[model samples]
Target chain A: MPEKTVTDERLLELLASEFTFEQGFALLVSAYKQRLYWHIRRIVITHEDADDALQNTFVKVYKGIAHFEGKSKLFTWMYRIATNEALSLVQQRSKHAAGTLDGNNSAALLKADPWFEGNETQLLLLNAIAGLPEKQRLVFNLRYYDEMPYEEISELLGTSVGALKASFHHAAKKIEQSIRAI
Target chain B: MSKNTGQELEELSPLLRQMREKGDGLEVPHDYFDDFDKNLKQRLTERGVRRHALRQIPVAVKRRIWPGLLVIAASLALVLGAVRHFNTGNEPAELAVLELSADDITAYITENAADFEPEQLAVLEETPDAGNQSPAPEAGKATPEKEEIPVEAVEEIIDEMTDEELAELF
Candidate 1:
């Protein structure tokens, strides 16, 4: 049988009830895990790191969901968590690779990733995006890849729409320049 | 925030439009998403066990643990006092515990069975002779007598408890 769609309101209700919490959590994971995985994958640049960040994101959500007062959309709240986890993983990885010979080379990491099916040009674009500053990289991914609205992006990132637009513009320009140089 | 009209990309950078056409080119292992929640369930369960293990003693159990120890301590003190009163010579107090028969000890415990309590019974049920049993609380149900410990205080205790301390707690 086809499953009935669970709305965010219904999800929150299910989560609030102790008896139905696991059921609601399952539905929540089924709903957002793929979307979140791709979003995290874009930032962390590898399946392994993305998986780690995604798991941590869900764990955080489980711990903090009770405090979520429904001030923002549930998707936005979860996206914020996924973004933070992805960035934290990147930071930790960079710290680990600081003095290593291989270093935290995203391009090399992407090429080595068994699941990355990109051609040379696609690889170059990903590499270019990876090279952008953290804020610019995040802005570009949410805008260019996910096609998330500027308003939603702003809400998730706690940045102004104008600043996000500007960051996206600079990110796109830098990525284009990087790809052109190669 | 405005809708992500495609026009923004063209005005921002033509190269980005072309790159989008090339796609992100990411893939997952076969059935990755299908198994993701199952794997996540396992992780969550493991986490639940760890957190539950940390809160091994409920507030009721905390209040009760000391009473069991006191009963044992008081019984030993009374036994020593009786031994000292009877044996004027320095025969040593250790011989009193040694002198008692298995039946005598069993009868004493049977007489005082009311003092053993459910929490101590739970510990004995879990470990017969191992002397170390899990101190996991009674299925996490709070009775009226449960004195709720603040979560911060529980966290503080969790941080300070070593393996030996945790074992002894059970």
Candidate 2:
């Protein structure tokens, strides 16, 4: 027999109910894990950080499930949480680096990472992106890599669509300048 | 790239266009997502069990503890109420007096006048003394003197005043 599929509403209903909560949550994790992992990976710039952030995001979602008001799409809400967790991890890493003699360079870290398959050109592009301010970097990544629409990105970041567009434009200009310098 | 200043990079620069075409180059271990759910479930289960253990107190202990907790809560409430009562001094008693009827006030004054100061008794006695006498000649029939106001009516006006107004009056 074919596996049964559940709608997001039905899944949420099951999650809220005592009998089916665990199974519903497991289904929810499986559905979004890969997408969320990549989204996090793009921001934090490493698989390990992405993994930690992803786990933290899921744990938070599980704990806060009862408070989920269903005002937004489940994925949008989860994306917001994932984004926060990723940014928080980056903030921690930045703090740690600021304390050390050698500041933590994510570009160098990415280049050294065995899992990264990008060539020299890709590395240059990534380094250029890494030079961006946090908000601009996020705007660039979500726009360039994820191809997320400005409206959805606006909802996710609580930023205006016009501001997001401006950030992306500035980010692109900066990246081009960085790439030329490289 | 330097030659193309002010031109749109997406259109002018092949590298910029290529970078856009070629997405972020991140990878994961083979079949990572396949086992990710199982691993997450294990962690969640372990966490759930840990949380459950923390939440699970012995019913016998709870039964014993509840009476002690209730006693403590009652003691706290009593302490707080006494503190509030003392803090407000005689305001509550005055409010209670305001709620009493004219007959009740007369009876209270008759019983408790000995306990009160002469000045306090004079304030209480002024109401009935004025009511028994005829109205003053200069006074309009429509507007009674403040002394001619019935004790009940005076109390009603005081009762209508908010706490701030009452505080301001005192």
Candidate 3:
């Protein structure tokens, strides 16, 4: 056991030692379990898939923890792993479900086009966001929905803040145009 | 350039202001995070199971892995056991004659039926236990295990040796 108090940071320090793999691993599971689950839940949008993806994420993290050289914070590393697992789950679920990877809500949008008739701004925003590539969609989601700063988005996506800012700018401009067109 | 701060900021920041003001996308339900946390904990548990199973195997045993590991394990147990027979350190002097010449081995088995059991000697003529990653086991069962036999002896006496003898000894 570590002589120091076992905060997450201190536990990380202990886990860095090969001698503390089990203790460190248990600590990791307990510490970030909830945060990771919620993060995955937002993307996959179903309890069953979220459950499966969450498990896969933890499994991946456990297998990959030793490879985590601590270049980033523990939560950031966990988030990255969770992100990959969630996106992969999304892709696989899309193949078997009514949704497609690129267009999960397209059918609903098409069907509800009449309902959103009064909400011209929403339609336009959707159009502009839909126009973006995958990476841009991710950047927009982090910046817009999560209200995250460029730095947090950068850490999560492993991109530079400068690049993320530029991406956000483009995304906003497109949304503006989409709304204007509506 | 001539515009006031209010007008400039309003026009430039229309999307940011309109996009639900950052903190207003959707208020999460009280149960939202709770369910997520439950699912996450369950996933962590499953991961623990897989990692625990991996940890149960000894490092040394996992090192020399092969496809036929279970069978190889059983055969190794029997072979090491037989090897321990001579290696016991307190054997009678006559029993220590496990290292005799081929002629002496056969003759001793033939003559000393009661004392020098031919069964033990016969094991010498049986096929090898089939070590992995070699061409030796390809020798048919009849070719005999001359793995312990000297290559010079095989070259001298057994010109009509089976493919197994040729493969194992030569």
For residues B81-132, write the lDDT of model 1, one tens digit per residue: 9988887765533343334433443355466556556654454334332112
Error of 2 at A39 (Å): 1.1
Model 2 per-residue lDDT tens digits across residues A26-48? 78887788778888887888887
Q: Which of the CAPRI classes, incorrect, acceptable, medium or high, describes model 3?
A: incorrect
Identify the candidate with maximal lDDT: 1
> What ranges in model 3 sit over 4 Å off?
A1-8, A14-42, A45-48, A97-99, A102-131, B1-12, B22-32, B35-38, B44-48, B52-170
Q: Could you tell me the TM-score of chain A in candidate 2? A: 0.89
Q: How many pairs of residues collide in each model?
A: 0, 0, 0
Per-residue lDDT of A1-182 in model 3, one digit per residue for the tens? 11223455555544556677667766666677666665665555445556677778777776665566556666778888887888897777667766654433632443343322324344345445545676887787666655566677788887997887778767777767656654
Docking class of 1: incorrect
Please give, for residues A63-177, the per-residue lDDT of candidate 1 as tens digits: 7777676667788889899988988887888788773112138778988899899898888888888777777888888888778888888898889989988898877887788
Candidate 1, which segments miss by more than 4 Å at Cα?
A1-4, A99-104, B1-5, B49-170
lDDT of 3 by residue, B17-136 (tens): 655443222123456444654655576675564442123222332333344587899899999998898678655333333344455544544564454335444544563322221345
Q: Number of the top candidate by TM-score?
A: 1
What are the chain A TM-scores of the candidates, in order?
Answer: 0.92, 0.89, 0.66
True contacts kept of each: 0.44, 0.29, 0.08
